[model samples]
Target chain A: MNLLEWLPFIVLIPLISSGIVACLPGRFWPWAFTLLAALASAVIAALVLPEAMGSELSYPFGNWQPPIGIEYRVDAANAFVALLVAGMAALALPWAKASVDQEIPERQGAFYALFLMALAGLLGITLSGDAFNIFVFLEISSLATYAIIAHGRDRRALLAAFRYLIMGTVGATFLLIGIAFLYMMTGTLNLADMAERLPEVSDTRAVRAGLAFIIVGLGLKLALLPLHLWLPNAYTYAPHFVTVFLAGTATKVALYVMLRFIFTVFSPDYSFVVLPLSSVLMVLAVAGMFAGSWVAMFQDNIKRMLAYSSVAQVGYMVLGVSLVSAIGLTAAFLHLFNHALMKTALFMAVGCLAYRAGSLKIQSLQGCGREMPWTMTAFALAGLSIIGVPTTAGFISKWYLILAAVEAQSWWLVGLIVITSMMAVYYIWRVIEAAWMTERPEGATRLKEAPLSLLIPTWVLVALNFYFGIDTRLTVGASSAAAEALLGVPTGGLP
Target chain B: MTDNGILRIIARFLIPFIMLFGLYIQFHGEYSPGGGFQAGIVVAAGWILFALIYGLKAGLEVIPEKAMYWLAAAGALIYALTGVASVLLGGRYLDFYAFEAFFNTPQAAQQFGIITVEFGVGLTVATVVMLIYTFFVRRKSEWDEVMRGSDAE
Candidate 1:
């Protein structure tokens, strides 16, 4: 079989490896095995892209056809998402080795095993063609993440993990109920089939209720504005490596599912016109952007600040979705990828600082920039990307979003996007000033630079941000194709 | 430790039957409602009852914590390896039809495949439950005290 034929292995390899890694002898077995698994997954993901970009690939388990047995589908949207997730896992594995050693000294094997399981879960979420299968994978990742988060050295990590568990469980339950409703209405759990049948019963109360439950359920998972209470603590208290992985990939997966449901499983007219979800989403997006940024500006802890900033960043993507236009959806898709690169690098840089300085407080960052020049430099560059500075990945997404808003002639939204981004600059600048301009406290011993293991991954992401920023062909091309695919337009647009 | 002589005698007599029944459920699972999950729980329940009547010490003696860890890992590996076996036999992962090449008929191979997979699941489920029990009831404070003593030494 060709690479496309083996798409299921992209998820299965990590899962099977996780089980094997858990049983392997020696302390380092988990790390080594996970890294190998991640590398294999990345290679497979890249190999599948040429096929994925051209058309969707669907594989049935044990040769059973869809709507009867489980199926894995890889369209441009999900294929790109799967590639992004697998690639992040590959990059994060090395960083996890050094950071996990310091953050969690014991159970390294279980930690790595769980990490791989989480990666497999994410890949499963993106690739599954069935709604119920998505939930199964969602819970698998959630269970693993809760344990990993609780493994943080801080005492509060346990409490944070507990809170996250409660909130996450509720979200999953809501999503499951919504899926059941859809299944009941349509008599099929397959998303493609649901899309075909949903319109026939669009006016039914059950269908409407299902849509509502799904949106709210995914809202909680994605940490969209008002429902984002569990995010800051979970992100702040989880071990730094876990933070980096989850921040980069977890919400992005949830957002992708939301997009899939909105555009593929349900008609846009029903969502945007009949239900007024567009208006609701637009209001929530604007509020989330303002409120999240406003709160982020005042945070004392650097990690928590970034966590809050994530809420704001999600707002931008949601805003793009609310626009309900081809360019708007493309902007949303591009931002999802761009934001992953930006946040993963930033969080990794923070992890480096936490490794050296022994605290994540902004005050502790003072004057360490000079001591850890390479690390801080990466921080600054990623910070600029967050601010949507020219010649960075963040700008590309924001540029398209602005053009989309203008096309819709929503000048106020244009103003809102620009203004909220200014807030992004202010918050990011706080860390920069602390790192670059402030003096090291009196009589403090000089700290050495972060280890190469951590610094290398951070810089790799930083370089990707700039490289993709300068050459927009890959990200833009894939996102536009995905956007067109979602909008039901023929796949030949330059949006 | 039990004051009731009849209770201990009855408990000793019943433990063997419980295990036998668990095995019966596990092997008969693919053709019936009871499968690996229920059988594993039943087996674990037998062990727990023995601990309750005979003391946790007797329970640990029968199935040590170290052994429990290995059992859990081994069970999961068995399940995973079966999938890999199918792939190696020129079929998709988890495709039992590939086993037809080995057996005289496809039905026998499928039966073999399902039974083995169920056995693997039973092994994992039982051990995991025992592991949790050990952590929750048996080790409570003594494990930490032992660690502390070792550190001091």
Candidate 2:
């Protein structure tokens, strides 16, 4: 069979396994099965990525032709994101057995089942070529996410999950309404077909409203500032492993969907030039950066602080998107990948700390630098990456964003980027200071290093952060190719 | 409610017909307005009526909580497996025409595949609905006991 033939299984394997996992009797068996399923799906995504980078791979469900039946279309952009999501799932699973055992001991089968369902949903969202199919997958993932979040031991976890559900449902509704408008106008759900038909009706108010709705709806999902209230609490309160998985993948997938809609379906020309969305996005992005970073600085809980930092990082990606250039899109995609690496590693490190300390408060981590050296060092390194220090994955993304801004001749935006990087420095410094400078509390129980099961995945991601930071071949090459594919140009100009 | 003779008698008489109608809806869905979702709800409604009249314990005796969970998973598994089977038979996922060799005609194969898929959907929907109903009907004290037990762990 051709490489494209295996594309559906990237989604199907986890989807099928989730059902099986749900029925499995024992905790160990369910977890073992989920890990194997995640590994299989990741391998398929890896196999398909090389082919997808060179050319689009389309698979029609039920052997039905497109513009009619749903299709799974893989190109450089989505294929890269799919690999990140699937790869993260694989990486996170090995860490999960230890974390889930400690954090949520009941209904382990259900927990693993939901985890796989969420993974399948995210992958499905990345692969789907139909607008409606994306919505279906979005709900599938969102519903599973809410349930998983509610599994946190704290009562606040339930409240956080409920808030997310309400906000997420509203966002999904807006998205569905937007899709309905577009379908009414274009008479097709297939993204490529819609793009072809959209030009004639692009000037219509309904189409414009549809565009606005799509942006706001996806904005919520991606936790764009002002719409990001659901994120910090949800991240802070969810089971530790869940926080790691979601921090790495969920918002990044949402951003990829937004990119697909804005660039592929709506056309950059229509979205940027005709609509004047670029400036609005620029303003929002910059505001998000400052607000997110500013709020992150004051947070006492390490998880909540990182959650806010994610909002800031999201702003950087959006700022890249606002430039509407090939280089800019590359920067956005690059940050999307790099952020996943650093954030997942950071969260895993936090999970390790939580595993040992049983708390996420920064004070709880005092002297952890001496006690859990491996875990704290991993955190510090990932923290350095998030601060956009040189020779880290985070630095490469910021470099590109600066490059994109300079190309657009927006010098003030460059200053803002640097300022946010400094803000990142201070917040990270607080944790580093507490971990390294403060002495262990007198009479405190001795804390051991996190078990290798968790540390290995954390360090692997930290290693990737540095590797991608220096190598730049895979990250830069794939992102530029993805940018070119999205823009339909050899360079930065609109098609 | 269980002490009400009229309600119990009527529920017993109506449930079989309600279930039979649900099956009819399930089979006739391709050409009509109702399909798995509607049929599943209808069939589940009959069981719910039985539970409401006969008591939750009696309903548990009939279907059991554990069986409901298994059935829910089984239903989804059946649906996904149908798609996987088509892929194995050299067709794209969920392509009913993959079964043409066995069914002797494309239309027949398509019908067979749709029916099987819908049946899976129906089974899952029914069990899940019943499960939700049971949970709602279950006492809050019982739920608290379960929660307290887990928390104690």
Candidate 3:
């Protein structure tokens, strides 16, 4: 069978498997079944790498033409992300088996069902060429997300899920209104077609209004500055497995949607000139960078601190995108992929801590460095990435972002990226020192390392950080191509 | 406990013709104002009326919680099934023109394909709304705090 033909299968594999998983009895061999399904999907997605990298593809739903039929478009940008998500699924499924068993109860089948559906929704969002289609998948994932988050053992999880629901509904509403406005103006919802129409009406009040509404709507979903109120609680309070998947994928996927809209659907010129999106992004990025760092420093809970740090990292992504340079977008996208690896490793390590010590308390983890050296080693490596160490993934993102800042000739913003990242170093260092240097307390003597179930995925992610740092060609090459496609410019320096 | 007012109002005013009109919009999507997502919302709104006016217990009697979940699953299946059916028919997944040249008509296939997914969306949205309501109202006696001084009217 031709590889191009499996475009719809990428989304279908996850969705159909989710249903099959739902039917598995609570006592059934669910882990084996779910892991097999997820790994198969990852392998299928990987198999398409050559075709996807070569050019963009559009598959019309039910044989309908565009401008009416829903389409799934696979470009280098989305294909790369789809691979990351599916790869993470393949890697993390074994870990999820035991984690879900330990954290949740008899509804294991349904939980796996929702997880696959979420994977489907995320892939659908990345692949969909139609705007409203994105909303449908977004809701699919969000509704399932609420159920999954609420399934956490902690009672506070209910409140966190409820809060997420309220914010998510608001975000969805804003996105709907924005989309309605766009449809009114262009009479189209197909993104590439909309881009063609955008130029003629760039200055129209409605288009600008649509731009403002869409950006704000997406910003809320992406957890930008001041809009990030739901993130920390949702991440920290959710079960360990949920935190790993959600923290690693959700916001990054939102960022992908935002980039798709700003660069692909609207001319970069219109977005930059009319909305001054770059400047607004710059301001929010700076605010998020410092605010997230400052708030994180005082937090005693390890997960909460990491959650806040995600906000700061998101700021760097926005900062990179706002530079409005090809290098900047590339940097942002690379960082997004890199940060996912870094956070997944770190969160998984935290999950191990919780499993052994029954807490991920920084103070309590003082001597874990020696006891759980594998996990601690993973944590230290991830932490070093967070600090932008040379030959690590984070360093690559930073280097590109700094170059983009220079291209924009904005030295002060360069300082902001540097200073905020240093703040990241301080917090990451705090955890390292606590985990390794301090003495192990009496009764904290659960000197056991995590089971193979968890260690495998965490280390996979950690090793990736170093691998991608050294072999920048894949990350940089694909991101640069995506940036060029989005900007509609030949690969070159900023205008 | 009962879905009153606009639910009933809209039920009477619009629901009567919505099936026909939803079909119309679904068909006109290539030429005019609606498609899968909007149609799905419309379909969901109808089921919402059932759950609202009738207590969830009564709602469960008609559309059980487990059943609704399965129906949601079915909607996605239908959407995917259309794609597979296309493939089976010898084109690609979702390649409608492979079915018939009627699709070559200006709006025929776009309209047809859109209606297909619209039904899918309707199924999902309706199930979601009902599921959410179930979550909130499953324990009806908890409403003593709301109605105040009595467990029932």
Candidate 4:
């Protein structure tokens, strides 16, 4: 009846179709079904985006009211995120068709089913308003993710999936415990209700313990440094398409949850001020930014390099959050969206290379620029965005982040941000040099360009990276509204 | 020396009753604590016991792989589509109040929706458990074949 009514369908359409698709016969049916599901979900999300930005949209299941039954709430922040997610899924499906066919030997249908399930779970997380329900959906996505990663043909993929499972379960367990503590303190599982009740009991040891546990749990999921060991291997060993989707969406959704919990469930004053968390977060963010970039430079595997770079990108986002101001939060949300575009494009381009060359090594890309002109060019352009080049999406995010640091009067953070962007330049140059500078091997056969199916999706994202870089209306508008909502002012002076 | 007499007789006698009890639990859940989840596991236990007594091939003949996949998918679909159906009827997603037009009263509609979704859940759970058991058991035959090959060599 209303746009808010359609929120559940955004998740259910994909969840139901995943099952139906699994039962369908034929090798192509799964991919076709996935594409249709993603497209439908994306369209629904677009229609709902305006409503979500205006006010919170909550749907209580089975006619039950909030604080008693589960609710699906969408605000400017998560709704924008949901749109980005659906858009990415729709774009990734076409590329997935070619990549999965090339990489996997059997069970294509099941793999597609898992992909849809994971999509549904991510959407569920973004839309859910219940604290415990978040855990339910988190596990759904995590379990499906483990299976998808294990679907990679590499023998090491199994190990990677197993390791992820172990770490992910521990994180989920801690999260569940945190939710339990909050429920104990507040006598409710609904996030809004908890936020209302938590203030009265904010000074208690139990509440503080709950906050500590929750942040630590999400920190693991965010892959903050020292807790980030499982990421590089998992990304490196997963199937190209699986890696692309997870790289773009999984941690970003986790970050959204962190944002929601810190700003909505627990008041910023309690979490950021009372606990002195900004200083701790600032230290971790700075360490992660440098360490992630430095290690990425030495990686021989292209996928591994990108995975480490993801760590660095995550640091920039956290650094923004650590500032605890409207501008700071805006920078964080903007970079989250920008990084998704850049990483998705980069990975899709790498998938194209892998399809033709059969390896993801830096060495394998030698002279690939000459052979696959469209894909290599896409990579180079997206690479510019990654390095914060002028007139690119990456540059826009770094610019805002620096501005936020300036607002906070932290010149050192400004300096660190610039230094990391420079480091990004060096590592990205390695790929460019390998693709453009090195001559084609003497005895090698001529490699054809990637199929149009793959090339189309890669370039669409690449085009958007530059387009949004210059025209910042949508990204800036959505992020600023979301940031103001989180901070409760145009420019918060909490710190 | 009917070596298999006890096993066959025991399986034939126990399987039907176990399945019947599972169905009883599945439908009786509304008045009691047990529901589709417990019932589904019980029903699957019946099939698993039969497979253990007989063999993998015979077990598959009873419920083939394709049928198992369809059953799993169909069960989940039944549960989800009921919620979707409510939305299409102009109610909130998964709200049984949408069914009030078809039923005698709102409470009746709620009852109908709950029962239907529970049935769907039971179907999915039972099918999935049976499917998993079948696959895990089938791997034994392959392992045996590999071991036999080594011995012959």
The most accurate candidate by lDDT is 2
Clashing pairs in 2: none
lDDT of each: 0.89, 0.93, 0.81, 0.88
List candidate 1 stretches off by more than 4 Å: B1-5, B143-153
How much RMSD separates candidate 3 from the native structure?
5.5
TM-score (all chains, Cα) for each model: 0.96, 0.97, 0.85, 0.97
C-alpha RMSD of each candidate structure in angstroms = 2.2, 2.4, 5.5, 2.0
lDDT of 4: 0.88
Per-candidate total of colliding backbone pairs: 0, 0, 8, 0
TM-score, cand. 1: 0.96
Clashing pairs in 1: none
Model 3, C-alpha of A95: deviation from truth (Å): 1.9
Runs of candidate 2 with Cα error greater than 4 angstroms are A492-495, B141-153
**Which is better, 3 or 4, measured by lDDT?**
4
Question: What is the fnat score of candidate 4?
Answer: 0.84
Best-fitting candidate, scored by DockQ: 2
lDDT of 4 by residue, B1-153 (tens): 124879989889999999999999999999987788989999999988887878767788899878888988899999998988898898877899899999899999998998999999999999999899888878888899999999999
For candidate 4 chain A, the 10 contiguous residues with the lowest summed lDDT are A486-495
DockQ of each: 0.58, 0.90, 0.35, 0.81
Q: Can you list the residue pairs that collide in candidate 4?
A: none
lDDT of 1 by residue, B1-153 (tens): 555788799989999999998998999887778998889998998898888788788898999987888888788878878877887787777778889988999889888888888899999999999889878986666888999999999
